[model samples]
Target: MGGEGENTAVDLTAGDPADVENDNDRIITEEFKIWKKNTPFLYDIVMSHSLEWPSLTVQWLPDVSSLPDKDYETHKLILGTHTEQNEQNYLMIATVNLPKEDTEIDARKYDDERDEVGGFGGVDNKIEISVKLNHEGEVNRARYMPQNPFVIATKGPHADVCVFDVSRHPSVPANNTVRPEHRCTGHTKEGFGLAWNPHKEGGLLSGSEDMVVCYWDLKEAGKTVAATRQWKGHTAIVSDVAWHCSKPTLFGSVGDDKQLLIWDLDEAKDAPVFAVPNAHEREINCLAFAPHSEFLLATGSNDRTVALWDMRNLSQKLHSLEGHRGDVFQVQWCPLDETVLASCSSDRRVHVWDMARIGEEQDEEDREDGPPELLFIHGGHTARVEDFSWNPNMERTIASVSMDNVLQVWQVADNVFNEGNEDEEEPADDDLE
Candidate 1:
């Protein structure tokens, strides 16, 4: 070592890389134990389930049920597999039971009943496969029809998509091939983007590497046909498409060409009404229109950052969020809070951003961190977070899936999101000292 800070960097050339990796694993394992031990203090309701195979996408269903007289509630979720084995791959509806309240088994006291990785789920609350239908291709993404939750749309590796009426399948879990209710075929190459119109019934949108976004009108009952319209607005791969929450004819798409195009079907079918070129520094992986505010949108990029935009004025970004070390995979606005947003990344973290907190004062420790609007960073996953979904029925709750075969559901601890959690109330002007 040299004097002062001259040789502060560790000499990595001297040690065996395998030993270093093992040490890192040991540290991570122990850190997980501590994180699980403090679960009660970190979440309103948290549960982690290790899956048999990795799922690439997840969405919460509208259905919720409870066992006879039991205080536990079971929530339905739709997820799809990405396995190479065609027989093993499926679009499935799974159920996870929740307690009447937060977990009662304190890990600090009764840590004996824990799994090898430190999860505390038992038989009552364990995840169960409710229905699984054979899928012909890898499910890159999946979404349920807003008006018809039983109907699910899945995007494949190519310009292929399968629509399944899950209600027609067996209610119980089984491994068997099931034909799709309909198929939407368009495009000439691969793509992993899919979206169902929230404002229009039987309306769907699919985008692929062919650089065209196709619209499907699935109102023919049992018969399915090719795309009714193809919007060629991008010169590269269309990564995603999102429908405006209230505007049936209005939608937006992001692509590899670094453009965010807003399409108005009422005006034109082939060209966008508004386009924001170079919306992100790199390929825009995903985009989401604010659930409550129609003019606000958020996008995540390959540049490892998330950007907030006002659709009314795209001259410049409203905010550029930087925290993730890997590419931002997806960005979504919380339905319960118009100003709140969430982004997941390949860096194995999910960040919760509160736009309302921007420009607010912060303590010394928070000032040393990144942005004041950074509400919380969730680092519970061990691998790259593939996808995540917010629970519309629950406040501040979200579920995420990772590459390492883990599905976790958690809600932020109230003190972090609730302003009433302040330790002491400031007196009004009349009562001020």
Candidate 2:
């Protein structure tokens, strides 16, 4: 009896393991099951709620209005880029933060009335710049459209980018922001590409679908206006342009003629410093430079391949990445990771590759062993993927835009295999009892 007495345990409650199982089953049924199946992660994240937010195009703008010196929290503005039958561009903007604790109705009510309370949405003043396309096929001029809170980007503050709406202005106030006051006369044809000079303030470049690249110097003279520089090149529609982050006057453009044109804005007549001919097998859609690797440049093309070129030895191709079946749309290198590059294609697939190992000295025989490893294939979109952007501040976050008119933000895990499976519940260790 004495030995057996030591084995005794207390059953202080009416509930047994069966009851525990039943309680958990009810709990999961009522609370966890729906969320576990639909939500992206066990915990809350920006992408946890749903994937219906279509439109791969998004920009992360930090709240610089506060403190002026210290960077505030970043917010993502997601929207679609499409021209409808009414000739109106419709877009939805969603502010991305952590999933909120507020109820759906409460959230809706808050958003609807946010501006009235002088909250984040209350700021009615947005910097507006207008781009005018002329018969000569150039962004003839860009001007600031006057409105309250509309400040011209001159010496200190600068507008991030200049956007064009194919659709004319609507009668509604909400729609008024979408309309251009004066018909921008610059590009002879519709400009396909618009980029702000990362180096020079108010300096912008626009590429025409008609095979011409124009530079615009935006200045303040009563009107928000942009003037074109004499610099012009590319025999075909310039599909993409990339500016050296540090070099203000230096930028490169890729055209349908399968050429890469590099320029120095200061030396307008000197021609491109380096012109890579036949850089792609087909039309090039986009180009990007490694954030750290100045000598490295990446281009995506209609030939379904992305080629990485080493500027030091441009005479030969560095690495030709192949896998995309359809035309490669956009390629972006991770701002921080030298080895990783992300590419999206008309095939509706986003592929990431690690090419740091593909060093210049690697022998052809060794390379025959294999190319860089394919990291992941994201396949959620149903239409041609148009553009994908990487957040400079966030790790493993990428935003992609597609012809489907949806913007998606994907948080790629470094270890895709380690993702938690919320479907199956693990039983507690019996011995612990």
Candidate 3:
């Protein structure tokens, strides 16, 4: 692989100043002002990079210690990509240096400057290192352990999941014979998703096409991999899996069987604590748990919709968000805000939804039973967007990867509805069954 550096600037001006006094310009400017007044949220692409191979998955480093201490900063990210020429897959780690301000500024100050005269200066981004892995099939998912950022776990078209150590060096091995520290093999078919336990170290979860969720313990030193537990609850291929943010023993999985299963490690063997049969009309493709809530969860499905579920009640959904023109591939809850969610789909659009209005009463005339409120729509990718990740340490910052062979990092403005809104009450813990 090769490395290159580029500096790109963002233009946020509503219109040109040269035509500010013309009649036609006045009409256009007025229309633009009206539009801006109606639009609640805005986003600007801060950094973009075109990779040689189509990126399948991208993730921000869990720890921000490597970044500079400043109000606005930059950090590192890892990506998984595949080449059609050699049919080989590789892992890339990059150091992205975003534009920064000289002095500390509040959100209002930043917004005023951005709206008046475009955004901050250019961004400095380049690849730090690229290493080839020993995977013969395409890599579907890659993630870093929350407590152990140096260790990464990857799963894909093969049944086995590979764990690598990046603490030694970021580049390829000097001897060109680098192998994974651990090779976890248990599933009978290709793996589709991988997630690391957030509250515990050395705990990893993998969901596969074989309809099983395998948990691995990498703390064991002598063994290549220690398979501690495996759960078989889905009747079809398991598409995705996610561990609860605050619950150490709780995790959720979605599958082609159109079911969302919640499993607890302390429960009985091979059975879920709760199962939502027919969670969607079509196959469920992805799942994410709210970062701050104990019971809020989100699921994306092939039916071109995203659904919010209150785990306390399994019989009904909290909200159904419909906007994607194609199958929804990924859904993620914002780590900073419990009421915000992000999703991407095969339609090449990345949508951010403000879910605070889910239970609010609407005026009869204004409410035609429309879908959930969309905060922002991002459409820069030329091809299908496969996956995206939110930076846990940053507010409203997200990075998305696509089949267009590009990775884009951007930030969304705060929601307009959040200015003077009161917190919504949580649902009662009454059982829905």
Best by TM-score: 1
Off by over 4 Å in 2: 1-56, 63-74, 78-80, 90-92, 99-184, 219-226, 357-371, 417-433
Sort every candidate by lDDT, greatest first. 1, 3, 2
Better of 2 and 3 by lDDT: 3
Candidate 1 per-residue C-alpha lDDT over 129-192 given as tens digits, one digit per residue, 9 for 90 to 100: 7777887767889999999999999887756678988888876445565578987877787677
Q: What is the C-alpha lDDT of each candidate?
A: 0.77, 0.51, 0.71
Query: Candidates' TM-scores?
Result: 0.87, 0.63, 0.78
Across 283-365, the per-residue lDDT of candidate 3 in tens digits comes to 99999999888989999999999998998998999888986767999999887778889899996668888787555555673
Output the better candidate (1/2) by lDDT: 1
Instruction: Write one digit per residue (lDDT tens) for candidate 2, span 1-433.
Output: 0000011223434778888767644643433233222222211122322223233344433221233332223344424324433333333334443212221211111122221111222233211112211111111112221221121111101122233332342222343243332222345555445556755654666566656666665533223344456345688877777776667788888988889877888884848888998988899878887777778888999999999888878777788988676898788888767788889997666777778444444457434433534555555444577667666555666666666545545545323312224653322223111
- lDDT score, residue 278, model 2? 90
Model 1 stretches astray by more than 4 angstroms? 1-34, 85-87, 101-123, 172-176, 423-433
By TM-score: ranked, best first: 1, 3, 2
